[model samples]
Target chain A: MNNLVEIVNLTKKYGSNVAVNNLTVSLPKGKIIGLLGPNGSGKTTLIKMLNGLLTPTEGTIMIDGNYVGPATKSKVAYLPDRTYLTMNQTIREILDYFQDFYADFSRERAEEMLKSLGIDPSVKMRTLSKGTKEKVQLILVMSRDASLYILDEPIAGVDPAARDYILRTIINNYNPEATVLISTHLIEDVEQVLDEVIFMRYGQLVLYTSVDNIREEKGKSVDAYFREVFAC
Target chain B: MLGKLMKYEWKNTWKAGMLMLLGIFIVTVAGCIVLQMPGGVVSNLVDGNEANAAQTWLVISSFTATLILYVIMLLASTWGMLIFLGIRFYRSMYTDEGYLSHTLPVTANQLFLSKVLVSGVWYLFIMIGIGISIVALLVSLMMGLMDISELSGVLTQYNGNVWEFLGDGIYELNRVYEEQMGMNLLHYGITLLLTYVAGPFITMITLFGALTIGQLSSKHKGLIGILAYAGLTILSSIIGSTVQSVFMFSTNIVSSAGGTGITTNWAYDINVLTSALVAAIMYGVSYYIMNRKLNLD
Candidate 1:
């Protein structure tokens, strides 16, 4: 299988401190990969660089065989860690905006998801709770038929039940030919849904292997292996 | 793509912009109505020379209040457009919303051009709206101040078209200025018009540049942006004044040394050229920062 994302000598520095230091990794297509790391382990920075929000200080990120720019942006669906939607806009307006901007976005799928979630399309974003807002953002990202989905902390800072809904939405909505890169620290919650895992520790990728391989080799859940590897 | 971007930009800013415009219209209309009634009474009393002190005071106060309201509305209509557009740019491009804005499938140049075009259109709209409101207010005041006989006489003298009367008045003034100061008032009028139209574009782009500079720093960015703008303004003003003085001095020396045919229109030409030059520099700097050094935090 060809890789959907390739990072070559990627090093992002703030001033003196390196956020992502000379990291190299490639993510194959058509799998849900969990990017597991603790806080400040450079997960978000890597995702931002892939999405072209932050220019790489040292190297290049290729998405779907194209360098990160407007072309790559069209193929990558990104869900940032925060609520980036305008507070005054309604759910319907945001969906319309996504549909207008992203040619791969499916308004029908978004509406169906909103209906399944029992979310009011006319409700303003500011009136929604933080968890609901996060869910809305996830639904929008998942409705896109892009080549890659890069979601940053999609399951963090929400209730366990909301987290389950988000995971289910991701599982149901992603296309079979596309890849989804989800960044989060809740390994146990996401392990069952992920086919592969990539672990980063202190701005370096420490592990990248299939979940089945890890389970077969270690005789334990991927979460247990994560706990063992990241233990201080 | 630029059109679509501007459509959404208009969607986000139209509420505030329209409300400000509506406020100007309402204030102008209300002032005109109040002035028409009170102004007639006050002028009639004064013309008859029969009003007591109390009545005079009441008329004066009423007229003054209406005048103040008209002035305030006029000022608000003009300044509010620029302020509102600037706020829209800052909020949409720099705040948390920037995450989506920058990630959209559009290049930075397209985004910048869309914003500049939208802002420019809205500025022109506000200027024209204000111009119409002022004309309406003046017409009302004229109607209120003139007695029936004087109004008829003036109406007949101007062939019943106030615009023609105003045009003739301007023509006379232009001729007087031409005779006295060797300045073609028509040329001055054209220069002023061009400057007025170009000034807002330059100002908006300069603000964008300062905002971009401020974004380079992570702390106290707003204050830094304001200070940067102030510094730019002061530096440009000093340079402009120095150039103007040098031009003036040289022109005076040459004219006194017997260059009679050479007109002082060079001064205004240079003035307009200098403004266009500054605007171009500001636009270039703004485009550079937006395209290359966009630090949207």
Candidate 2:
């Protein structure tokens, strides 16, 4: 399989404190990878670096064969942890903005998804509940036919039903050839969908292996292993 | 892309812009009415005489208009800056909303360019609005619809050549308008577009500088951002003042060498261009910072 994302000796620092410490990881195409970590474990930092949101203190990251810059950014879809939509904009307006900027944006899928959720595209984003806003954001992100979808805590702030809907949206709308890197602490919920897992701790990657490998080798679920690895 | 970006920026700030424009309109109308009021009515009500009523009204109206104009200008610019820098940057980075912004498959340069374009458009609109209000007042006065002699007197006191100044000002205005009009309505529209772009360009720099400092600081992210902004402002101001002082001193030297006074046409034009160049440089610095070191994470 072709490597979709390659990070070489990546290091990100906030003053004297290192956020991502000399990390080297490469994600293969067509896989759902869980970037698991506790708070302040550098998952967000690493994810940010991959998306070209943050400049690495050292080393390089390549998206496909291209260096992570303007060219690569065009191919990557990012869903940040917090709601990024302006409060005043309706769902339809946001979608229109997306269509304006991204040629790959699937307006049909977005409208259909919103329709299924009983979300009127004309309703302002600020009027929605937190979970609904997340859904709106998810719909927007997933509607794009991007090469890679980097979702930072996609299900972090929602109820159970919303989480399921968000997961289903990801599954339903995801392009088969693309990669999905979802960062979340809800290990069990995402474990079934995630083909591989990368566990991070204290700004370092503690373990990176296939979910199948963990299940087959340890005869234990990813949740059990996560508890063991990140147990305080 | 820039067009779209500007459209949205304008949309977002439309409420504030509209409010400012409305306020200007109301003030202009009120001024006209006040200026048109019979001298005797105002004088009898206030001081019991119609004498010097036009002058009184003009002074009051001009002062009021100037104040209103300044406030509206400041508010419009502030709104533009806030939307261009504060809301847009926050949403583009550091928030879940950035998913839409960063994932749009557009280059950062496109994003930045769009913001600058929107800001430029709005700023131009603001200047035009002010100009229109002034012209409305002038037209009303010219039609003998209002007592504008008082206002004219106040203007003369400031420069002692109201008619000449008005003529020169109108000529300059026409020249700018004609230059823009030559490009069709599209080009004329883009004049404001380019001007508005400068606001966001400056804003991006301030934001980048603030974020850089925020990342470096151990605590007080907001406070640190403020300090960073202040530092940048101070640095720019000091540089500007120093350059102005140098130019003034040098111009004085030249004037002395030519055995003339410090006032000269060449010196004035040079000063204006120098300031414009400085503003351009400041904007360039801002663009560079945002382009090179935007820390969305």
Candidate 3:
């Protein structure tokens, strides 16, 4: 259970172009881990495999000691990079849906977050601004008392101020015993809050170490080092 | 979980269906009523004056236009319902909305069954709506041609024993048709009804299976899905025709080269069996794609 996510030799290919190569890694519990990578580096692909969105071409992903099935899905809260909700449905309906399916979903927590943002639960998703919709999606994801939170580009769509609020929500609201796996290209903004970083390059793991170690041992911030290594 | 999925599935799909059904009811009633107007006008033609003739022509022209519109509305809405359901499945299970649906704590079978069952139920409701509309149309047409008293007497003769009345009605119908042919009309009707009810389920499976196949493509997935569906339908029709021809040639069911061809019920039964088997296979294929071969971008 300490290793919340165990991906073993996972590979996802589209016709012969490998998206996620034979990548294997173990993520520990109770830490905010930044899955940092450049564009097309397979960060979202790997996150998708863990959330059961894409079936891996090979290998396995075990979350909370369960294979990526319904049992594992109940423990993983996934926020995809796009708006996955229907435009016609009200936020209240989606909340009911989540509460019905995921035992870990908390309606009160989600409602509280919505109230804080001055968003009416009765408002249809179509009526919300893109940034507000992303915030709502983040709210729904963070409201779940899940064992693993897999968020893909969670802050990419929001404004700078809302990004800070969303980052705070992610850092403060998640289960202390759970792990949060965030995939994003904006490493500098997230490096401060990350307990650890898993830097990926070309669908291969480049580094997996603590943020303190990156700053202390490498004598550079994660942002400064990332810019140096991934500079085009 | 399947029930919960179906609840939302029903909610998401029912609004357009309700509106379509209401439109069908309104159009059928109004069309039938207006169709009675031309007959009423003719019956009241006293001396065929110039104004009366012009009015009659106007009425006839309007009636013809209304008839065309009614037919078009019925046919378009029926086809529209199927297309809407297919789009629903594609959007919720294949497009951006799939991110929410796939990540839920539910199995692939649950998702597939929810869409199939909901779409099937909608088809059944629509068939019933169409059936009721047809009955209304026939009743109005009959009323226009016959006296109200005569129609009331006919209704009274049945004494509200609907089962007996239906039985007698079918018996009379077959007794008349049996003079020239020797096929069971009830059996043929039952087969048709089965196809009417079950056809949409097969179509639903084909659509979902095709969309699932569309996932294999890098782009133009929805269009590719439509092409796949067209391919499946063409393939099914070929299979249906082949099976039908085989039954015809093997059994030698025709009376003569042109007299009373296909009088037996074997062809309809085989058609149902073929559709059922194809749907089962496609259902299995769609489930497999959703389960293992899913490649959402």
Candidate with best DockQ: 3
The numbered model that scores best in lDDT is 3
A170 Cα displacement, candidate 3 (Å): 1.0
lDDT of 1 by residue, B85-204 (tens): 877787778777888988899987788778877787677677777777878888877777777798679879888999998899899997786665556787877877886787666676
- Which consecutive 10 residues in model 2 chain B have the weakest lDDT in total? B180-189
Give the TM-score between model 2's chain B and the true chain B: 0.57
Candidate 1 chain B: 10-residue stretch with minimal lDDT: B258-267
For all candidates in order, the CA lDDT equals 0.82, 0.71, 0.85
TM-score of each: 0.90, 0.78, 0.91
Per-residue lDDT, model 2, residue B245, is 68
RMSD of 1: 2.9
Alpha-carbon deviation at B196 in model 3, angstroms: 2.3
Stretches off by above 4 angstroms in model 1 are B34-50, B142-168, B260-279
Which is superior by DockQ, 2 or 3?
Answer: 3
Interface root-mean-square deviation for each candidate? 1.4, 2.5, 0.8
Per-residue alpha-carbon lDDT of model 3 for B1-297, expressed as tens digits? 999999999999899889889888888978788656544463343335344667677666866877787888788778889889989999998889998899888999998999999988887788788888888877766555555676567768887576787788888998765455545687788898889888878788887888888887889988998999899888888998898778756545455545554455676688788878888888888888888888887
